[model samples]
Target: MTHFVTKRAPAVALLIALLLLPACAGQEAAQPTIAPTTGAAAATAADTVADAATVATPLPATVPAATPLPTATLAPDPATVEAAASPAAPTAAATRTGANYVLSLPREAAVPADWLMNPPPDFQTRSPGPGDTYRFACLELPARSTGLATVGYRSLEGLPSVAIEYAVYPSATEAGAALADMRQAASDCIEFTIGEGDNAIQAAFAPLDFPAHGDDSFAMALTTSGPTTGDLLTHVIKIQRGHVVIGISHAAAASGPLPDTALTESLAQLAVEQIDALTGE
Candidate 1:
C-alpha cells in the first residue's frame, strides 16, 4: 500500500493528508515496474453494511472530486522508488464534478504536466482514456519477472474495489512456477478474518465469488467484512501498458456498519474502464 491518505467526508481532508505524507513526495517510473499510486483521498472511507446491490446513480458526467496527481519522477534506486511512484502518469490533468473523473490516453504523446509520467523506462505504453480526468488505482507489487502479487483495494463511501496483478515472463510455465515465492508471501504475510476489516493488511480478500473480469485468467479467492467505522480513505491506481491494477483502503476511527463498498467498486471500475478505454499501442 504506497501511502495512506485520510479523506474528511467526500474525499478531501484525508486525501490531502495522503498527498502531504513524507512517504509520498515525488514519483517516477523511468523503467518497467509496478509503480502504483494509491492516488489521493476524497470519499468517506468508513465501513458500513451496504443496502444490498441497490441501483447506483452513474457518477456525474463532470468528475467533481479527484485530487491533483503529482508529477512522475522516473528515478532508480529501490529506496527512491516511492518518490518516483507517488506521482501520476504521463497525460493530461483530470477534472472532477461531484466524484466523476476522466483522463487522457498515452498514445497521444501529448501528456499533461500534472498527470503522472508513464512509460517509466522498460515498461510499455497504454492510453488511460480519451478524456482529461479518470479514476484509477495505485498499487505496489512484487518486483520479479514472474510471480503472483496479492492485490486488493476499495474506495471510500463503500464502493467496490478489485485487485489482480499480471507479471509476464518468458513462458507460461516459467510464469506459473515463478509465482511460488509470491504464494509464500501471501501465505506468510496475508491472512483473512471476517468482521470489520482494518489492519496492517486486509484480514481477507472479499467478494467470495470473485469472477475473472474479461481476460482476468487466475483463479481468485474473495471475502468481505460485516461492517466497521473509519476516519480516512485512499484512492489509488497502478497502470503498466497491457495490465492495469487498481484498488483502495479505508482507515476507520471506529468499528460498525458503515458504507464503503460503494466507493470501492466505483473506484475499481473507474480505473478499469480507463484501462479498457486506453490504446495499447
Candidate 2:
C-alpha cells in the first residue's frame, strides 16, 4: 500500500508543473510590447509632447493682433521733378552781374584809335516811352528790363559811329521775348522818317545775313538819306545770351564802302567776349 501511494504522488506533481508553464506564457503575451525610441520616431514623440504642453498652457486674457508690413512703392527723383516744374530758371551764365557782361574801354583795342566813347547825354535816356519821338528809340534798351549798360563810339571825323547796348531781364524767356519785339520794331520802322525840314532824314531797312552768335542772333542794315546829313548806313546786330541781350550797331556815311570785314569781325568777337564773361568761361 505504501509503494502505490508514492507513484500516484509523482504523477500529480508532473501535471501541476505542466499547467503552471502554460499560464506563465499566456501572461507574457498579454503584456504590452515596448519599441526602441530613435530617429523619426523619437522626433515625433517629442513633437507630440510639445503639442500637449502647449494645449495645457493658458494664454493672456487679451492677445494682441498681428500687424502686416507695408507694401514697397517706387518714387520719382526730386531733382528731375524740380527741373521739370521750373522752366524759367536761366542757364549757368545768368549768375553774372549786369556790368560784367558789358564791354569795357580797355578791351576795345580792336576798335579804331580815332573812335572814342562819346555817347550823347540823352543816348541811353532815348528809350522810347508812350508818345516819345526819339530818333534812335528802337536801338535803346527794351521795356521790362531789370538793368542796362551802354557804350557808344564816335569817329572824330563825324561820319561813322559804333554803339553797344547790354541789358538783363528777369529770365531767359523774357530776354528772348524782348529780342523778338526789337526785331518786330525794326521791321515796322523800315521806311520811317526822323526830324523835319532840312534836318529830316528818310531811312530804309533790309535784313543782313550775319554769323550766328550766343543763343540767338540777327542783323539788319538801315540806309538814311537827308539834305544835310547826305546818305548814311547803319548795320545792327542783336544777340541773346541766357538772361542778357546785346545790340551792336555800326553806322557810317553811305558814300563810303560798307564797314571793312575787320570791323565786323571785331564786333562779333566783342559779342563773343561779352558772352564768355557772363558764362565765366
Candidate 3:
C-alpha cells in the first residue's frame, strides 16, 4: 500500500528573515563624524571622509518568495491496483479482502485459520476440465454479464485442500437453470477422461446426500487417477442462491471415497450461513 504525503514550502523561514532586516539596515547606514576648522581637525576630517567612504552601503529591497499550497494526493484503490497487477492471478489476501463483487458472501474473517485461502494459479496442481471451458465464454453465462470469484484453502498441515467458486448469471432464473444442467452433467460425467493418449487421466463422480440449501442443491464425490498422484478424491457441493451459483470442492488423497468429514461439512455449512446473512434471508 502506498501512502499519500504533501510537500510544504519554506514560508516561515522567509518571514523570520524579513523581521530581522530593519536592524541590519541601520548598521549598514552608519558613518564616522569629525569636527573641522583647525589644522589638527583637517587631518581628522580627512580620516573621517575616508572612513565614511569605506562604510558599507544598504542593499535594495528583495521580493518575498511565493508560498505554494499543499497539494492533495489520493491513495490508489486496492481493487484497481490488484486488477492492474494481475487480473488472471489473484492472491488469497486479495480474494478475501478485495472480493467485494458479491456483497452477501462470506468475508475473509469467516475463513478458518487452518486453511490457506486463494492459492495462486501456479500453485494449483489440477488442469482445466471440459466443464471449465464453458466458464465465461459460453451461452450459459454471456461474456459481459457473467462474473467468477473463487477462494481456495489448503490445509496448513496436510494435502487436503478446498475451494469455493461463485459464478454469477444475469438473473436467478438463468443461474437456476444452469445449476440444474450442471447437476445432470455431474450425474452423467461418471468415468470421464482428461488429457490425451498415454497422458490421459480417468475420472468418476457419484452423487451423495447433503442437506439442501438455497433454491436448489446437489452433492457429489469425484475420483480421479493421474500419472503422478495415483488417485485422489474431491467432495463437491453445488448450491444455487439467487443469481449466483456456488461450487465448493474439497479434495484429498482417496483414503476410501472422500467421505464427508467434519471439516468439509463445517466449511459448507459456514458458506450457507454466510450466503444467508449476505442476502438478509
Candidate 4:
C-alpha cells in the first residue's frame, strides 16, 4: 500500500487528543483490582469480615453529610467532532482535467526558454493509430486510463525535445498496475521497430536508473537508428502518484551530447511537485 504524508490542522489534532484521552484513562483504570488470595493480606481481610459478621455496629445519633463525587470531563464540541470524522478535502488540481498538470512553456522553470509546444500527430489519443509501430509500453497509454493529456516541446536551437503525458485512472491500484506493466514490458522487449518497409526504424531499450519519486516510478532509454532517421536516443521517466500517472521523455540525436542530468532532475522534481499540489499534500 502507498502512504502519503499529510499535515493536520491544530483543531483536528486537539479534538483527536480529547477523544482518545478518556479511552486511554479507562484502560488504565480497568486493570485487575482483586488482590492475591494466598498472601497475609488475604487472611486479614477474611478475619475482618468474620468479626463484622459476629458483632453488630451501632449507628450514630446524627448522620454526617454524604461525600460528593467528582464531576465528569466536558464533551468535545459538535463541530469539532464532525470535522475530525470527515476525510481531508481534495485540492482544486485533483478535480480538474489532466491538462492542468502538464508542464507549460515559460511557467515552468524545468522547461527550456527556447522550447515551444509542438504536439505530435497522435497527441491526446487514447491508443496508437494503425501506422504507429512503437511497441514499448511507455510510449502507449494504458488500456484502463480514463483520461489523457499530452504536450510536447521542441527547442529551436536543436536541443533535446521534451514530451509530457498525463493520464488518470479510476483508482490508484489500476495506475500502479499500469506502471508495473510498463516496467515489465521494458524488461521483456529489448528491441522493437517503429515502422514497416524501407522506412522502418530499429530501436533498442535499456533500463535507466533514476532517483525514486512519487508512489512509484521507472525510467528507460530507447536508441533508434535507420536510413531515414539517423541514430537517436530518448530517455523516458514514468511516475505514478495515487490515481494519476505522468510520463516525461527527452529525445535527441545520438551523435549529439546526451540530455543534461540537471535538466532531467529538475523535470522530475517538477512532476513530483505537481502531483503533491494536486493531492494537497
Q: What digit string (tens of lDDT, one per residue) describes model 3 on residues 59-160? A: 769967889999999999999998899634322322432144344344455556654443321111122223342321112222221555554445443335
TM-score of 2: 0.55
Better structure of 2 and 3 per TM-score: 2
- What TM-score would candidate 1 get against the native? 0.29
Q: lDDT values of the candidates?
A: 0.29, 0.52, 0.49, 0.54
TM-score of each: 0.29, 0.55, 0.53, 0.59
State how far residue 247 of model 2 sits from its true place (Å).
0.8
Query: Which 10 residues in a row give candidate 1 its minimum summed lDDT?
Result: 20-29
Summarize candidate 1's per-residue lDDT along 87-147 as a digit string, tens digits.
5443321321111112322212222223222111122222222222211112223232321
For candidate 2, list the clashing residue pairs, or say none: none
Q: Locate the minimum summed-lDDT window of 10 residues in model 4.
A: 1-10
Model 2 Cα lDDT, one tens digit per residue, 1-281: 12222222212212111111111111221111122223222111111112244346778999899898998897989998998997443226445454454433224466788764534111121132343221232343335455555555555544356656665666789778877766776777667765457646576779887888778877788776655445666777778777667766676656676755568657766766656554543
Error of 2 at 182 (Å): 1.5
Arranged by TM-score, best first: 4, 2, 3, 1
| RMSD (CA, Å), each prediction | 21.0, 52.5, 33.8, 29.7
After superposition, candidate 4 runs with Cα above 4 Å error: 1-95, 102-108, 120-142
Runs of candidate 1 with Cα error greater than 4 angstroms are: 1-184, 190-214, 217-241, 250-254
